[model samples]
Target: MSDPHLTPNWSTSALLTIDVQRDFLSEAPYGVPGTTEVLPALARLTAAFRTARRPIVRLYRRDGQDADLVRRTLLAGGAAIVAPGSAGSAVAADLLPPGAPPLDPDLLLAGRPQPLGEHEVALFKPRWGAFYRTELDELLRGWGVDTVVVAGCNFPNCPRATLVEASERDYRVVLAEDAVSGLHDIGRAEVTGIGVGLRSVQDITASLTFQEVS
Candidate 1:
C-alpha cells in the first residue's frame, strides 16, 4: 500500500481518540508530560468529526484484575483514573462534545453501545488496540468505515500500538500529530515507515472538507 499522505480524501475516515480520559491528562494520576499540550487540537478534531457525522471512537482502559498490563502499571504508579466505576475513569470533560450524553458506566462495562451525542459513541478497550478482543471491528464494519484518523494520548504505547494494529486490519490510517502526545520525531518516522499518514490537526482542519459518510 502507498503512504496515506498521498491520498487527499479522508472524509470517509473515522476520528479515533485513544485513551483521552482523565488519566492521561496533566491533572490525572497517569498524566504524561506532553499530554496537556494536545487538548485544544483534540477538541477541534472531535468537533470536526462530530460535525461530519463520522465515527468517533474513544479508547479507554478499565482498572481491574483483568485489565491490560499497562493499566495495572499505571495504577501502581498512582494513576487511579482507569478504575472501572470511578469518576476519574470517565472521559475528560473537555473531550466530550457539546450536548453529548454522559458516559454510562453500566452500559460501557456491559459491552453495550452507548451513544455519544449524535455522531459519536463510547467504547472501552480491553487492550492497546481497539480491535483486541473487542467489537470495534464489527462496529466499524457496520458503519462501513474504511479509514481511521487517530488522535489522543501517549504515543509510545497505546496510540502507536493501535495504529500498527489498524494497518494490519487493512484500514487506511492517519495519525493526527497535534492531537497526540509522547511522540518523538523518530517515533513519528517509524509510523511513516509503515505507510500510515502523518498529518497535523491544523493541516487537516485547514484543508479538509468533512462531508458526511454514508
Candidate 2:
C-alpha cells in the first residue's frame, strides 16, 4: 500500500541541500559531528543532478545579528561560526562543482541567491528552514518544480525543517537518507510519518540515469 503522492517524480524534481557549509563540516569551528562522513554520497547526488541538468540548490547558514538565540550568544562571544565572507562559511568544497565561485555572503545575507553553476545556485537560510525569509519557494515555483530531493549536513535541524515545510507546501519530498548526516532510526520513522520518501544515494543517481536513458 504505497502512498502514491509520496512516490518520487524525479523528472520534475530538484535537489536541495541544506547547511553544507565548511563550518558544518569536519575540522571547522562548530562543525556538526557526522557531517563529514556523508560527503561522498552527497557529492554523488550533486554531480548526478548536474549531469541530469536538473536544478540544484545549496542552502547554507551565515550567522549574523539575526541568528538564533543560541548562535547569537556564540557570535557575541567571539565565535566565527560561519561568519560572513569567511572561507569557513562557504559550501564544503567537495559538495560544489569545480571552479564554482566562492559564495557571496553579502548577496546571500541580503536574501539574494548567488550562482554556483549553470543549473545550480546557493542561498543563505537565515533560520533552520530554507523557505523562511528566502526566495527558495519562489525559485522552485518559477522553475516548475513540484518535487524536491533533499540531502545535506544534518537531519534534526535544517534538513528536517526543510522536509517538513516542503511537505506542508505540497511538494513531493524525498530524502536521500544516506546522503545526509544526523539521521537515526527514530528520525527515519518521523520523516516517513510526514510522508517523506527515503532513498539511498545509489537509488537516486541510478533513477536519474535511468530517466536519462529512457
Candidate 3:
C-alpha cells in the first residue's frame, strides 16, 4: 500500500452503487429508513462519477427459484418486493438518468451486465457483495480498475458486506458517508478500522470536475 499520507490515490476506480432499488428507497418493499433522506447526495455522487469518466456499476438484487428460497421467503415474510421484472425491482426514478436505458430483469437476474449510462453498467448480484458469484472481479481487472467508490443503501447489510469483500480482494475502498444509510456508529467505526475512507458527498465532489456529456 502507498503511504497513508498520500490522500488515497486512485489510479482506476469504479463507482459501485449498491441495492438502491425502488424497494430499498421508499415504501415499495423492504425499504430502509433514512434511505429517502439521502437522495440528493446519491444523485450528486452518481453525476460526479459520470463526469469523471469512472465506471459505475449499479448492483441489483433479483429473486429466482433458488434452493434458499425457503429462507428468503421467511426473511421476506412471504412478500417479494425485489422479484425479477417487478416494478419494485427497478432502480428508483430519482437515481436513474432521464430516459435511461431499460434493464432486462431476466438478463441481470442470470448474473449479467445491462448497459445503463455512458460508462455505467448494471449488474445483478446474487447476494450482498458485488464480488460474490459475479464477474465484477474479472470486469474490473479487464478495465484495469483498482479502487472502489461505494455508495447506496443499507450499510449494515449489503453495503457493509460488499465493502469487506472488496477489501479482502485488495482493492482500495472508499465509502461515501452521506450517500449511504443504515450505518450505526459502531458499524462506521468498524469500517474505518479496515482502512476504508469515509467521506461526505460534497467533499468527494469537490475533488474533481464532472465530465461534459453531449
Candidate 4:
C-alpha cells in the first residue's frame, strides 16, 4: 500500500472527525483524557478541509435504547453520556465552522447524514467503528473520496476501530497524529505496520489546496 503521508491527494480525501462531542471531554463519569488537548489541532484541520472544499464527516456517538449491551448497561444505571438531544451529545461548538448547523440527533441516530456545510455533514455511529452498519462508505463513495483522513477523541477506541475498518475496506488512510487523543508511540507503530500513514495536522494542512468560495 502506498503511504498517503508522502503524497496525499487532498482532492480525493475526506476528513473524518470521530466522537469529539462535549461528553467525551468532560471531567470524570464520561471523560476521556487527552481529548481536550487535541481540540486546537482538530479545529485547524477542520478549517483547512472546509477551505479546500473537501468532504468532512463529523461522526458523533449517540446512545439510545438500541445501544450495544455495554452502553445500554451504563445507561440503565442512569448514565447521561451522549444521550440523543442532550447538550453532551452535541459536537463541540468551537470545532464547528461559523454558521454550521447544530447536529440533528434525530437524523444522525437514524444512521442518516445531516448536512452541516457545503462539504461537511454529520453522521452518528452506534458502534466504535463508523463504517459498521452505517451509510459512511456509500456517502464517501458518492462524494468521490478514495482516501480518509481520521482525527478525533480516544485513539484506542473509536478512532482506532474506524482506521482499521477503513483499511479493511481498501481506502488509503491517514491518521492525523496530533489531532487525536489516547495515541502513543506503540499504538502509532501498530497502525503504521498495517499501512496506515501517520501525519501531523500541520503537514496535512500545508498539503491541502484551498478553493475560493464565490
lDDT of 1 by residue, 53-124 (tens): 677888777767667765677567764566776766778767787777767777787776688777688887
Ranking by TM-score: 2, 4, 3, 1
Q: Please report how far candidate 4 places residue 40 from its true position, in Å.
A: 0.4
RMSD of each: 2.8, 1.2, 3.2, 2.6
Question: What are the clashing pairs of model 4?
Answer: none
Tens-place lDDT per residue, model 4, 107-208, is 877778998878888988888998998899999999888889999999998999999999898888899999999999999999998778899998888878
lDDT of 1 at 163: 92
Q: Which prediction has more favorable TM-score, 3 or 4? A: 4
Q: Candidate 2: minimum summed lDDT over ten consecutive residues — where?
A: 1-10
lDDT of 3 by residue, 1-214 (tens): 3546324444477788998888777564568898878778999988887778778899987655551454466555676767777778788776766678777987886777888867788998887778999889888888898788888889987899999998898888889999898878998899988878888888766654522221
Worst 10-residue stretch by lDDT in candidate 4? Answer: 1-10
**lDDT on C-alpha atoms for all candidate structures:** 0.78, 0.89, 0.79, 0.86
lDDT of 4 at 60: 85
Q: What is the lDDT of candidate 3?
A: 0.79
User: Model 4 segments beyond 4 Å from truth?
Assistant: 1-7, 26-28, 210-214
Best by TM-score: 2
Error of 3 at 109 (Å): 1.8
Best by lDDT: 2
Error of 1 at 195 (Å): 0.9
Residue 107 accuracy (lDDT) in model 2 = 85
Question: What is the lDDT, from 0 to 100, of the residue 142 in candidate 3?
Answer: 87
TM-score of each: 0.88, 0.96, 0.89, 0.92
